[model samples]
Target: MSRAKNPKYESMSLEELRANMEKSKKELEHAIHNKNILEQRKRIVERKERSHRLIVKGAEFEKAFPLSRDLEQEEVQDVMEQLQNSSYNKSIVRQVYIAALHKEQQQIAEAVERAEKGDDS
Candidate 1:
């Protein structure tokens, strides 16, 4: 991207300089538009991926508790509240939460190690 030294700028007419300024403005506008398109597409993909994940999770949940498919939302919430109120279920929930957190930490540590190795190379 290095530009070669030229004496043309010193001798160029005012009109020439104005044309170059206009060209730069157009280039800047196009660059911004291109970046905005890419960002918009990225957001669209993220939204679609999230929707797909939720659909998959819903299907799995329905498979596990077929009766839940017929139950109202309030009923489901009520059932979950009761489960949480029970000490046994509460303990189990905490254990599951801790396990998930530990798994996430391990994954992050692994990623950091991989990144460090890459940097070393």
Candidate 2:
């Protein structure tokens, strides 16, 4: 049986790269429809490698490529505001609130890192 070379497209030839990108795009669209976190993450990693290849090849990649809406700024802000204003037992709320904050921070950090690296994802 033949092996799957790699899911990453950066080091692949042009045809392989395009195929990988198309696969990623379709997976992303499907993930959007079904709201699957695993598919969404697979898309992120695949597309990020695609973007890196485009950069290396001097292609003009679109800056406004659609991003997944799962962890948007508005949602994070709403969660933060709710955590701050809601009255609850400190012992109970603190751990949950801190966990949410940590998750939000990780999402923000990932987004910023992707942005800095020129991946519009």
Candidate 3:
């Protein structure tokens, strides 16, 4: 029988990563209870690797496209309420937020460029 190749954890979706973590936890527990030293060590290493992958993914996501923190509480609540009232999915909401943030940043950059070019008005 041929063995299946394991997929790389870094490329896994969040849900898949969580599932892998749960599986690794169970395997580690079983290895510990069975007193299998080799399996226990292997499971520990796998679990740590998965955890590191998750952390790196989170960091990359935050760095590449972060939500705006300048929004006031009232504005945030209003957006949340509107989103809740609509049938929009989480992905749609995320896209809207990212688009708004990108537009705002672009406007700021353009204004700065104009000011640097000696255009005070």
Candidate 4:
């Protein structure tokens, strides 16, 4: 025969009520621990995905300028930040690289010119 459901909790003895309260607290703590574990796993997955995307994008940027030196991870990260902060079109990755190179060259040339003038003085 099918067993009857447990009797109403209101009819339970004081000891029974205390036992139930302890059981309920344990269940609540277990549920909370599981929830925290799942959140940690989720964060780990998100971090891996972000790192993978950065690696792939950095490789793509390098591919576009095959003759140029490969960009270091820090340089790629800086460019990524700039791309995110600016309104430039994402497709112009090569152009961005070239522009940055030109700017660096200009800065170096200006510094050399100043140094030569100082030496002459």
Best by lDDT: 1
lDDT of 2 by residue, 1-121 (tens): 9977665654789998788789999999987877777778899999999999867543321233233235476865675577577666455678888999999999999999999999996
* Backbone clashes counted, model 2: 0
Clashes of each: 0, 0, 0, 0
List ranges where model 1 is wrong by over 4 Å.
1-10, 71-95, 114-121
The digit string of per-residue lDDT tens for model 1 on 11-71 reads: 8889998999999999999999999999999999999999999899778878988998899
Which 10-residue span in candidate 1 carries the lowest summed lDDT? 112-121
Clashing pairs in 2: none
The true-structure Cα RMSD of candidate 3 reads 20.4
- Residue pair clashes in candidate 3: none
Better of 1 and 2 by TM-score: 1
Instruction: Give TM-scores for every candidate, taking all chains together and pairing residue i with residue i.
Output: 0.64, 0.27, 0.29, 0.54
- Every model: Cα RMSD to truth: 5.9, 23.1, 20.4, 20.4
Candidate structures ordered by TM-score, highest first: 1, 4, 3, 2
lDDT of 2: 0.73
Whole-model lDDT per candidate = 0.90, 0.73, 0.80, 0.83
Candidate 3 local distance difference test against the native: 0.80
